[model samples]
Target: MKIIRKSDPVNLRRTVDQGTVEQRKIVQSIIQDVKENGDQAVLSYTERFDGVKLVDYKVTSEEFEEAYDSLDGEYVQILKEAADNIRAFHEKQSTKSWFDTQSNGTILGQKITPIDAAGVYVPGGTAAYPSSVFMNIIPAQVAGVERIVMVTPPGKDGKVPAGVLLSAHILGVEDVYKVGGAQAVAALAYGTESIQAVDKITGPGNVFVALAKREVFGDVDIDMIAGPSEIAVLADDTAEAAEVAGDLLSQAEHDARSSSVLVTTSSSLAEQVQSEVEKQLADLPREEIARKSVEDYGMIILCETWDEAVDTINEIAPEHLEIITEDPFQELGKIKHAGAIFLGPYSSEPVGDYFAGPNHVLPTNGTARFSSPLNVDDFVKKSSVISYSAQAMKENADKIARFARLEGLEAHARAVEIRKERWKS
Candidate 1:
C-alpha cells in the first residue's frame, strides 16, 4: 500500500474489462445463434464453454434434494436466516400504485408494475456464491415478480454448486438452470425451448457475461454494467489500525483490479495501517491476489483535515465505504457518494455481503456518484397515469396546445385541441 500525502491525488480507477473486439464478435454470434436455434444453440455453447453435455439443462427435484443433503444443516439454517433478513429489507422497497384526485376531477397517478420475469445469472468461479443468489432474487420476489429464472455454469460433472442450489431452494426459486456464460445471457434475453425469455436480467459475471449483458441490454433490461469490486475506508485517529487493515484486505482479495483505499486525518494511523496491511497480506489464503491488489491499486492517504478526507472520498465515489471515526454518523452525512456506507468498526464490509440485509450488488468504478444499489425498484417499473376531467381540460387546454406547438409538434397540438373541441360539442 502506498501512502499519499495531503498534496498528492489518489487514483483508484481500474480499466474495467469491456471485452475485446474478438470477444464482442463472439458474443454477437452466440446471441444470434441462440435467437435462431433456441435450445440447440444454448446446449452447444454450454458444452463448449462449461464442458458438460446436458440432456436437459433445468435442475430437477432430485437435484434440489441432493443440494439440501450435501450441505450441513447448520449452514443451511444460516442461509435461511440471511434470506429472511434480505427479504424483509427488500419488502420495505415495494411500492403501491398511487393516484391523486383533483378538485376538478383530474386523476394523476403512477402505476407500479413488476416485470413479468427476471433472469439471475450466478457466476461459477473458484467457489459458488450463494450470496449472489440471495441478493438478486429476493428483491424481484419482494417486488411481486411472478417468475425468477436462475442460470449458472455447470461443473464438468454436469451439476450446479450445492451452495447455490441450497440458497435458491431456501428462497423457493425452483427455476434453476445448468448453463452459464454469454450463452446463458442470450437464453435469458431470447427464449429457448427449456428457458423462457425474461423482461430483465440481474447479477454479476465474467467479462464475457458482462459483454453478453451489454449486447442484450435493449432487448431486455439489465441491472448494470458492473466493474470490479472496490472499497474505501474513511477513518480517523480513534480507529484501530489492525481492524482497518483487515477490512481493506477483505476487498483486496476479491480481484487484482479491486481497489482498497484508506483516507484518514491521522498520520500515525496511516503509517500503522500501511504496515499492518503488508503484515496481514502474508497470512491471507488468497495472498497472491490480495498482494497484487494492494501493491497496485491500494492506498493510504494522509489528510490534513476531516473536510479533506470527506472531499477525497466523495471524489473517489467508492463502491463500499466505512467510516471509523469517533463520529461516524456525522461523517456519514458529510459524505455523499458511496454505493453502501458502513459506519464504525462493527459494520464490516462482508457483513453486508453475506448475513446483512442490504443488496451486495452495488455500483463500482466510481459509478456510485450517479447510480444506486440494486433494490426492489429494479424489478418493477412505473407508468404515469393521467385522467383529465372536462373542467380541468377546459381550464388548461390553450396552455397545453401552445406548449405542444412551441415544440413544432403540430399533431400533438391538434390532438389536444381535438379533445377540447369534442368536449365543447
Candidate 2:
C-alpha cells in the first residue's frame, strides 16, 4: 500500500482523475446507441456482453411467480425481514407539503410530490447483493413512487440471479428487465418498446454503470455516481486491531479498486492492525481482490495527534469513516465530510450495510463533501407554491416590475405591469 505522511496532495488528485475520461467516452457511446436503436440495440448488447440471447427483454409474470416458488423458505424470510428494516428506516424520511397563511391572504408553502417512476440498476458481477435491492427500493416506496423498475444483466444461462428476483418480489417491484450496463441506463432514460422510461434511476454498478449514470444525468435523475466501496478507520491505542482490520477487509473484499485506510496516532496500534490485515487476508476467500485493493489503495498513517488524524480524514472525505477511539463521540463533531460515520468498536460497516436501518448507498470519490447519502428525499421533489391575493399583487406589482426591468426583461416587466392593472379592481 502507498503510505504517505500527509504531504502528497498532487498525487491524490491525479489518482482520482485516472481512467475517468476513458470511462466516460465508453459509457457515452453505449447511451447513444441505446437511445438511437432502442430494444434492438439493447438485445444486441445483452447478447454480446452477458451472452444471454433474449427474445423478450422484460421479465414475464410467469417468471416472477416461478422465481417466488423456487426460492428457499429461509432465504425468503430473510429478505422480508430486511425489507421491513429498510422500510422502517426510510419511512422516517417521508415528508409532506406544508402551508402557512398570513393576515395579508398570501398563501406560501412547499408541495412535496413523489416521482412518477424510478429505475434501479443492480450489478451482476462477482456476487448478488440482495441488501442492495432493499436499499434501492425502500426509499422510492417510502416516497410513494408509483412504479419501480429494476434492471440487471442476466447470467450466461439467460436468467437473473435467484436472489435478485427474491429481493424484487419481496420489495413489491413489478417491472423487472434483464438488461444491464449503460445500455440498461439508456433503456430507462429513453423508453424502449417493452421498457418504460423512468423519472429517476438509483442503485450501484461498476465503472460502466457509474459513467453511464453520469452521462445521462440531465435526461433522468440519478441517485449518485457510486464509485467503488471504501472504508476508513480512525482508531487510537485503546482500539482493538482485529476489529479495525475486520472493518477494513469488509470493504476491501468488494473489488480491486476498493480502498481501506487506517488513520491513527498510535504507532503500536498501526503495526498491530497491519499484521492483523495480513493475517485476516490470508484466510479470506476474496483475498486476491482484497490484497490488490489493500496494496494499491490501502494505507496506515501514524499521526502525532488525534487532531491531526481527524484533519487528515476531513481532507480525504472517505465514504465510510469508522472511529474506534477511546471516546468516539468527542470526535464525531470534528468529522465534517463522510458518507456514513461508524462510531466506537462495535459499530461495524456491515451492520449499516445489512440491518442497522441506515441507507448503505453512499457518495464516493470525495463527493461526500457536497453530496449526501441516498434517502427518501432522492425520490421526492419539492415545488414552491406561491399564491398572492389581488390586493397583495397590487401592493408588490411595482417592485416586481422594477426588478424585472432592471434585468432588461421587458416582457417579464410587462407581464407584472399588466397583472397589476388587471388586479387593481
Candidate 3:
C-alpha cells in the first residue's frame, strides 16, 4: 500500500463502466430478441452465455425441496434469523397512504402504493450469496409487493445454488428462474413467455447485466448501476492496526477493482496499518485478487488533523465508511457522504453486509454524494392526491387563470375559467 499526505494530487475517483461498443450492441440485440421471441430466446441465451441447457426455466417444487434437503438444518435456521432481521429493518421503512382535509373543503394528501411486481437478480456464476437474497427481496416484501421473482445463472450442472434457493424458500418466495446475464435482465424488463415482466429490477451482476439495466431503465426501474465494492476508513492512533487492516482487506477481497483506503491523523499509525495490510494479505483465501486490489486501488493517507481526515473522507464518498476514531459517535456529525457508515472498530463492514439488518446494496463510485442505499422506498412510489373543492377553486380561479395566461398557456387558463363559468351557471 502507498502512503501519502492529504496534500498529494492523487485522484481518488474510480471510473464507472458504461460498457464497450460491442457490449452495448450485444445487449441491445439480446433485449430485442427477448422482446420478440420470448422464452425461446431466453433459453437460447441461457445455453450460450451460462453454458447450460434447461428444458423449462422455472424452479419447481421438487427443486425447492431438493434445495431445502441439501442445506444443513443449522444453516437454514441462521438464514431464517437473518431474514427476520432484514424484514424487521425494512418493515420500519414501509410507508402508508395519508390524507388531510383542508378547512376550505380542499382535500390534499399523498398515496403510497407498492409496485405490482419486483424481480431480483442474484449473482451466481462463481459464488453464491444468500445475503443478497435477504437484502434485495425483504424490502420489496415490506413494501407490500404482490409478486417477486428471482433470476440467477445456473451452475454447469444446471442447478441454482442450494443456499440461494433456501433463502428464497425462507422468505416465502417460490417464483425463480434459471437465467442470468443481459438476457435475464431483458426478460425481466420485457416479458418472456414463461417469466412475466416486472415493474422494477434490483441486485448486481457483471458488465452485460449493468448495460442491460441501463438500456431498459425507462421501461423498468433499477436500483443503481453498481461498481466494484469500496470502503474508506477514518481512524486515529487509538484504532488497532491489525483490526483496521483486516477490515480493509474484507472489502478488498471482493474484487480486483475494489478500493480500500485508510485516512488517519497519525502518520505512525498509517505506516503501521500499511505494514499490517501487507502482512495479512498473505493468508487470505482470495489472496491473489485482494493483493491486486491492494496494489492497484488501495491507499493510505496521512491527514494533518481530524477535520482534514473527515473532509478527505467526504470527498471520497465511498460505498462503505468506517469511523474508528477515539470517539466515533462524536465524529459522525462531520460525515456528509457514504452509502453506509460503520462506527467504532467492532462495527466491521461485513456486519452490515451480512447479518445486520441494513441493506448491503449501496451506491458506488462516489455516488453517495446524491444517491442512497437500497431501501423500502425504492420498491414503492408516491402519488400526489389533490381533491380541489369548489370553494377553494372559486376563491383561487382568477389568480390561477392569470398565472396560466402569464405563461401563454391559454388553454390551461380557459380550462379553469370554464369550470368557473359552469359553477356560476
Evaluated with TM-score, which candidate comes out highest? Answer: 3
Stretches of candidate 2 exceeding 4 Å from the true structure: 1-4, 7-25, 422-425
Per-candidate RMSD, Å: 1.5, 2.1, 1.1
lDDT of 2 at 217: 88
Writing each residue's lDDT as its tens digit, candidate 1 over 261-370 gives: 99998989999999999999988899999999999889998888889889989988999999998879888788888999999889999999998899999998888888
lDDT, ranked from best to worst: 3, 1, 2
What TM-score should be assigned to candidate 2?
0.94
- Give the winner by lDDT: 1 or 2: 1
Give the least accurate 10-residue stretch of model 2, judged by summed lDDT: 10-19
lDDT of 3 at 214: 96
Candidate 3 residue-wise lDDT, 1-425, digit = tens: 99989999989877679989999999999999999999999999999987888999999999999999998889999899888888888888877899999999999999999999999999986579889999999999999899998999999989999999999999899999999999999999998889999999999988899999999999999999999899999999999999999999999998898999999999888999999999999888999999999999999999887889999999999999999988999988989999999999889999999888999999999999999999999999999999999999999999999999999999999999989776856
Candidate lDDT values, in order: 0.91, 0.86, 0.93
**Model 1 alpha-carbon miss at residue 123, Å:** 1.3
Total colliding residue pairs, candidate 3: 0
Model 1 lDDT at residue 151 = 97
TM-score of each: 0.96, 0.94, 0.98
Which window of 10 residues has the lowest lDDT sum in candidate 1? 8-17
Which has the better TM-score: candidate 1, or candidate 3? 3
